[model samples]
Target: MQTGEHPQLQQQLMVQNSSGSLSFNSNLSKEDEEMSRSALSNFRAKEEEIERKKMEVREKVQAQLGRVEEETKRLATIREELEGLADPMRKEVALVRKKIDAVNKELKPLGHTCQKKEKEYKDALEAFNDKNKEKVQLITKLMELVSESERLRLKKLEELSKNIDSLQ
Candidate 1:
């Protein structure tokens, strides 16, 4: 065989040459031809069976592939639907977060105002307590002055009565 000759062509050529030689030499009988024909028929039947089985398997594979594609499309649609539903919720969440931030910003000043008011209230309470202490001291001084005046008036009255008796 030449280097470039295909292996399959070489095998066909060899088979043809051998069969020609056998027929020319009368060594291949009619019974041998019949047996070869039967074997070829059997081989053809087997090849047809294999082809049928291959076709059935191919069809089954195609059906399964179609089902898989449908399933994939269904799942994709479901994912899209879920995402669509979530869009509003996602926006609502963002809005709620913004509102919370706004409320927090407003509360900061209120907290400071509360602290200032608490301080003012404490200062006022301290002033009131100091004034109450001063009032208690003034009331004590007033009671002492009243007692001294009463004692002076009684002594004056006794001196006047003795003078009247001497005159009589």
Candidate 2:
């Protein structure tokens, strides 16, 4: 007869109760126990599912961390090797520069010597040219003396021929 209570819902609950057919207090405890068992089972299944997901995530993270560690070690080794190789190359470059400096030092005196020799050769060439000019002048004078002697000899011969003709 209450305003909030529904007669149809109360009839449905009464038909579900089991014991004597007309009893108001029936076996509702068994139904409450079954509902509690069902709720507990559902909660346990959900907890198990959550635990499985957590384990899967943990495994993925561990694998990623291991990969990172391996890559870090590989990079470290490569860096060490590069540094090792660079050390010797650095020393070699320094040695080569030293050798080049030594060569430059050695060449400076040789360059000065070569320049002095070239100057001496030019002076010698100039002296030889002056001597050649004097020799050419002497040769010209000798040629003129030989020509005058030949002319005098021809005049003497002509005079002798004339004297002989007069005697005849």
lDDT of 1 by residue, 125-151 (tens): 999999999998988888887777777
TM-score of each: 0.44, 0.42
Highest-scoring model, TM-score: 1
> In lDDT terms, which candidate is top?
1
**lDDT, candidates in the order shown:** 0.76, 0.74
Clashing pairs in 2: none
**Candidate 1 wrongly placed segments (more than 4 Å):** 1-85, 161-167
